[model samples]
Target: MNEPDVAVDEALPAPRPMPHGLDPDGLTVGVEEEFLLVNARTRRVASQAPSVLAAAADRLPGLRPELTRFQLEVATATCRTAEELHRQLRTARGTLTAVAREHGLRLAATGSPVLGRVTPPPLTDHPRYEALIGQYGALADALSLCGYHVHVGMPGREYAVQVSNHLRPWLPVLLAISANSPFWDERDTGHASWRYLLWSRWPSAGPPPRFASPAHYDSAVRTLLHTGAALDAGMTYWDIRLSAVHPTIEVRVCDAPATVDEALLLALLTRALVATALAATEPAPAIPQHALRAALWRSARDGLEGMGVDAVEREVLPMRELTQRLVEHARPALEATGDLAVCTELLDAVLRRNSGAARQRRAFCRRQRLTDVVDLLTAQTAGATALT
Candidate 1:
């Protein structure tokens, strides 16, 4: 697939006609992935991120820490297309993996793992994190979890807010696609994304209400902060939200996908969804907040193995059919971005091979050891497939 035209400020030598009805100049892409560090021998959560970062300080530029010492995050610079995102994903994962291996640690890109056991490592020594530890206590401590967030550029705040509202119903399908966390605390949680469950423990986490405008969105965020439901604007942890810092709509529904392919797939589809929402002339459907919550739970519980909520119908559908519906919904934007063929191929690949959760379970069944799942995730995180 051709990379999306990323040149924003300067004119191209020759402008190509935008295909498939996408606003070629309007949409850009960025991704943030959080990964867990585990001891190489024991496959347990390792508080060695600091050491790894210190060792590779000059090598990995975007590498940084998460809430816990066991987690590390890498953010990709804004890019123009799926191809660029794929390349960035490979470089980030490969560099991080090499650095961790030097420290006798392994990097696994899943939502949550059994390695943390009863408790995760201590919080990072940041003052803001210190405040979270003091306020949220165990809720903050047990957060050895990680997620992949996709950001799609919006024209402005209004479009970002509207796109966020329109994209709500589709969030579950995306969640099911990237559901990589099935085991937690050394036991199978039976849910595809145990990370989502762990994350929702925070008062400010979950789906955001439909906003009339960007001002309404700002007001809602202020309410959460004033009531102490959130520590700050950054903690608004909606499954999807207009980003607080960047000028993009960010989707936080996915687990830290187990492979670079799956991570790029998530970013491609997310950009398509945002583009589709922006092109829509009609208002987004009004599914009740309760129904939306139920839909999210259904996606987390069944993933691609069973039925998922049909957000519009407020009922259930086989995940296979639900995924196809999503593809069809985003077809135009995918084609416009030159990602339709790759996205369709990847979607078929995911269905045929099964979700990361299913694959992890299969690995565990083969060995009857939870650490096998950890090993599998560790290996898969390192550029599972080469990008053409």
Candidate 2:
């Protein structure tokens, strides 16, 4: 059944103000995690988000509808510490798990659906969404992808744009760590993140251009709007961009990870990256756009298990080496935020078990059934099982 667009309640908590005299090192961070609603029995995408969200509204007031009825999203209140974000993510995911279960559905954090239906999934009943479908046609029709976004507070929009330049080279490394969509349409797509390929169909959805200044960024967005490549500023779907509604830089590069801890790891790493970028005295390297694109493709194809392109060096290297370099790049910031130890532990765990995509493929190989992969994702989302 098609679901009506559900409005988010104002009762949701606002971004928390930084405590008095808190070290600016502790930049506020928030995350928005998108999830797919799956039928518990059939293990297929279920267009029941409106009812699931309605049932969860009073208890889990932060829940909101997404572009498609088969998906739901929740944003964390602004947080200063990883511990605080961890608690909030756990509470939200737990509540959503119970709510979805009661409504005969399961919340799966995988990037794309593992099963297929005869018809396209229904879009939420919103006029803007209808217009998007009218404008983009098939590109908008294949919009059932879920992503994990991290928003780090910035002093100003111009500074945020500058920081994004520093962030460009590391984007592929981050995507490799969080690549979670290996299966789609009941088959292994052989790519760690099929969602990335699917999402790239949008003309405005890949890596953002390196802007010389805030004016350059604005002019580029204006071009997208004038050319009808994007319906609005919100549609400037760069991998990272200044948030339209928040005083933060938003990184929208990863698939929705399978576990809350994975989400926390991404959030902490992103905050550290932003903080590191802000403190740097030297200019960021001007890596060629073609090199960066090649790096992104490698990250999406091989995830953490294979070679990755070093955009800075213009050479291919082991993903493990690139992953370590990313951690080292943000080491000072991680230490300042007291998250270095935790980040190290999480990185070790992910490497030991493999990326989410690798784990999902392993599950399918064990039983040769897509349903087993769905079960794994459902369990991981609910924190019912270790992401082993």
Error of 2 at 296 (Å): 0.4
149-175 per-residue lDDT for model 2 (tens digits): 999998877678778888999999999
Task: Count residue pairs with overlapping backbones in model 2.
Answer: 0
Off by over 4 Å in 1: 1-26, 118-120, 384-388
RMSD of every candidate to native, in Å, equals 7.9, 8.3
- Kindly report which residue pairs in candidate 2 clash with one another: none
Provide the overall lDDT of each model, using Cα atoms, as 2-decimal numbers: 0.83, 0.87
lDDT of 1: 0.83
Query: By how many angstroms RMSD does model 2 differ from the true structure?
Result: 8.3
In terms of TM-score, which candidate is strongest? 2
Query: Which whole-number lDDT from 0 to 100 does residue 58 have in model 1?
Result: 85
Candidate 2 global CA lDDT score:
0.87
